[model samples]
Target: MCSHIFNERNRSFSGREVIMINTDAEGIVVDRPNRFLCIVNITKPVTMESEMVHVHDPGRLEDILYPGNRVLLKRAAEGKRKTKWDLIAGDIMGEWVLVNSSWHRKISEWVIQNKIIPFLNGIDTVIPEKKFGDSRLDFLLMEKEKSIWVEVKGCTLARGSVALFPDAPTIRGRRHLEELIKARNEGHEAVVLILVFRQEAESFSANKVIDPDFALTFSKAIDAGVKVFPLCFSYEENTIHFRSLLPVFQKS
Candidate 1:
């Protein structure tokens, strides 16, 4: 098992320890044809012209995917691929926010493996995408005989200093919350781990205005003993790393 421990002695040029990430190149958004593809002007390949890139995030990122917005892209591995670049992160309000949903699972897995998240430490085994009921959960952590079901969500929508999830309405997200509640009721530890891809967030809340059903379901999940953990992180250029955990408002 690979474990990462934060060292105060090691620091980067910005006075923060360099957090390793998976992105390779930088680009400026030219246009987003749809949710899956975006046209960007590459900065690393010396490409003065705009090129179409793949966007893995399914959410409607109106706030971050604006024209001229700085974006981080991962170059596709040498082979036949749909697009040469994959849009992963974006600069919003001067901070780099992770826009890719694919990283949500990996980041949460890293935290769990490193035992960085409070109350979820000492995991003996970590399993990804485990089946529980009708849905596939993000992780199933085993510690001795005790098991925990974890669902991870990437939060990119922020209003001022407050971070919110599901910028758009998501019936799927609400269903996941219901499953978490079910797992909790069956004598297993259930958790919804929210990864806020911003640094300035003071607290975490469900976007009730956008999806009232999700908000209500989230509250019900909490009432049924489902734990919700929201943690903040920041990225600059190519490095991405954890910052700290934020206060969770299940009712908000």
Candidate 2:
């Protein structure tokens, strides 16, 4: 298996070693009245003062999005929609954790294209949003005549060195695992690629406390030959640095 991917750079100028996704305006979060909208005090990059920013992550980010927390925002296009900015990342425990779902595809594609993962090093082509049965997975990797179906999940909740997914209950996430099991049954290599945005996360596991059903289905999928890779990353100053591959939690 591949160990940690690090180079000769600190956490700030870090991701020049990896993918450098950009973010513009900075803000201090005020409140999240609903799931998709957050009121923030835009402090930099043409300060707009108070504004409604679109939140892309669905996870319950009480720890990061609380009042007065620093965040990164990407300004929406001129006259694009109602919301002027998008919440991209938040400062959590001294690390910038990427909470944006929009970057998941770019990060995953970069990792795949660069042949970072050992098992996926042989991938020749990557097809996005491919349909498999009734489900549309994130990517379909083609290597020779073999097919590999992948579903990507962005994880933001972590405690100490352990990372847990779906800070809130997710029936849809459970269904995704079921579809992965079905793909495995059909003799296709199925995988759930978890992007752990928490920089300190050394391992990943299902949030059984939040959604027991998802945790149960997660185990079932693993038992049914679905591979899971909980990879660690950190978002720092408009760039994302690949950290390491975390293992699944196995209870004794």
Candidate 3:
């Protein structure tokens, strides 16, 4: 009966816990001055020509943030802010992807609460930003006395049907992988959940070409009993929802 409920929720496309966004405007990317800001030409709410927007993602989005590429922005909710728009997602290679890293935690939490993943089933409690050793993991789920530390990574860069993480070199990400391995060694379950923000990706891998150090660390972490779960999601209009689980392409 519980299994049926979980499967039904996954099948619904939009999960019951989905964050609703009533208003999202389409735009064209004009320029991104830095990691935190972008200039986009709004095409909705009277097509106000050009407006500066807040980019919630800090990673270098070279593949997606090209000039003239279509983007989706949510209007700042009646709040006094420097920018009236927040860049949420953008189109790449004919597919829309959620680029806002800030939403990663919420999406992960929704997945856990809805029991969308098989391994995460039967979780009795979900704690966010749990400190383990010298690192703060994204989530610490408990089932009775057993605990599982999970680190979530948002992957927006892909080549062909393969998705990759840390489009830029990330020393911080490598350290988290090391700590997850340590947790596994100490008799607790450890997992790295890759949120592949793409539509057609069939598999995922650590970006060895961009960050070889992270790639090597990921390999070691998996060998030390750390599990990897890569799930693909699609962005349509104003909604971003999980589509299906993806296989991890092991590096040879």
Provide the overall lDDT of each model, using Cα atoms, as 2-decimal numbers: 0.79, 0.83, 0.82
What are the per-model numbers of colliding residue pairs? 0, 0, 0
TM-score of model number 2: 0.90
* Full candidate order by lDDT, most accurate first: 2, 3, 1
Among these predictions, the greatest lDDT belongs to: 2
Tens digit of per-residue lDDT, candidate 1, span 1-252: 322222112222222333466777778999998999899998865665578888888788989888899888887777888788788888887778888876677678777876666567778888998999988988999988889999999898988888998888998888889888989889999888888887888678888989998988987887798877777778865666777767765443
Instruction: Provide the lowest-lDDT 10-residue window in model 3.
Output: 1-10
Root-mean-square deviation of each candidate, in angstroms? 6.4, 4.7, 5.5
Which candidate ranks first by TM-score, i.e. highest?
2
Clashing pairs in 3: none
Which regions of candidate 2 deviate over 4 angstroms? Answer: 1-16, 45-47
Tens-digit lDDT string for candidate 3 (1-252): 111111112233433325644446888999999888999998875687769999987689998888999888888868778999889888887777888888888888887887777778989999999999999999999988899999999999988988988899999899999999999999999988888887777778889999999999988987898888787888765666677777777656
Residues 1-252, candidate 2: write the lDDT tens digits: 323322211122224346676788889998899889899998887777779999998878988999999998887879859898889889987778888898899888877887656778899889999988887889999999989999999999988888998899998899889999999999999888898899887778888889989989988988898888877788766778887777787442
lDDT of 2 at 1: 36
- Sorted on TM-score, best first, the list reads 2, 3, 1
